[model samples]
Target: MNDEASELKPSPKIDPRLLELLVCPLTKAQLEYDAVAQELISRTAGLAYAIINGVPIMLPDEARDINAVTVAQP
Candidate 1:
């Protein structure tokens, strides 16, 4: 690893390219970025994927659930 690599802090923004490639690991569905919550949400599957310090928490146990109202909508 380079010196700069170690010094790099986690980014708040998810790269457009990276986002395009990212999927909800549980369902393999598309993920929506919630900048305010810093989470990658999968409405289809009712899972809210968290992004801590810019790195995504892909673990199922780490994810939160969406509300009933939010999930009810098409």
Candidate 2:
């Protein structure tokens, strides 16, 4: 495959151990991995943290509010 085509491929799955260790920074609750969306869902916190290039972006400011409600500032 060409470089461009290769670049379009999905990122490798995140380490299971790392996922087990991760928690929602806001709620300190367990996270659910959504591989299809490349996000870590925090149902308690109503947020979805994006996983970029196999790395989870845990920053609340960078997270997307899955519930459509405002994420309070820290």
Candidate 3:
């Protein structure tokens, strides 16, 4: 049931070392990468920031809203 277009591949442009410096702007929480989900997860805020092509989407709208309900639905 997964959408092919929704699949986000890790960007060659993103430096792994730089990922260490990227923090969630909302909650200021450390982000962990979910390669399968192709997102950087803010565990505190429960938000998933999309990786578009090779770029990490730092914008708010580009981020997916997440919650227990959404997780359950997904």
Model 2 segments beyond 4 Å from truth?
A: 1-4, 69-74
List ranges where model 3 is wrong by over 4 Å: 1-14, 68-74
Name the top TM-score candidate. 2
For each candidate in turn, the TM-score is: 0.72, 0.82, 0.68
Better by lDDT, candidate 3 or 1: 1
1-74: candidate 1 lDDT, tens digit per residue: 69898678445798788889989888999999998788999887888988988788978788898864544666
Tell me the tens digit of each residue's lDDT in model 2 across 1-74: 59999978877798999999999999999999999899999999989999998889999999998988666999
Better model by TM-score: candidate 2 vs candidate 3:
2
What are the lDDT scores of the predictions, listed in order?
0.84, 0.94, 0.78
lDDT of 1 at 59: 80
RMSD of 2: 6.0
Candidate 1: pairs in clash: none
Collision pairs in model 2:
none
Q: Alpha carbon lDDT of residue 50, candidate 1?
A: 89
Winning model by lDDT? 2
* Candidate rank order under TM-score: 2, 1, 3
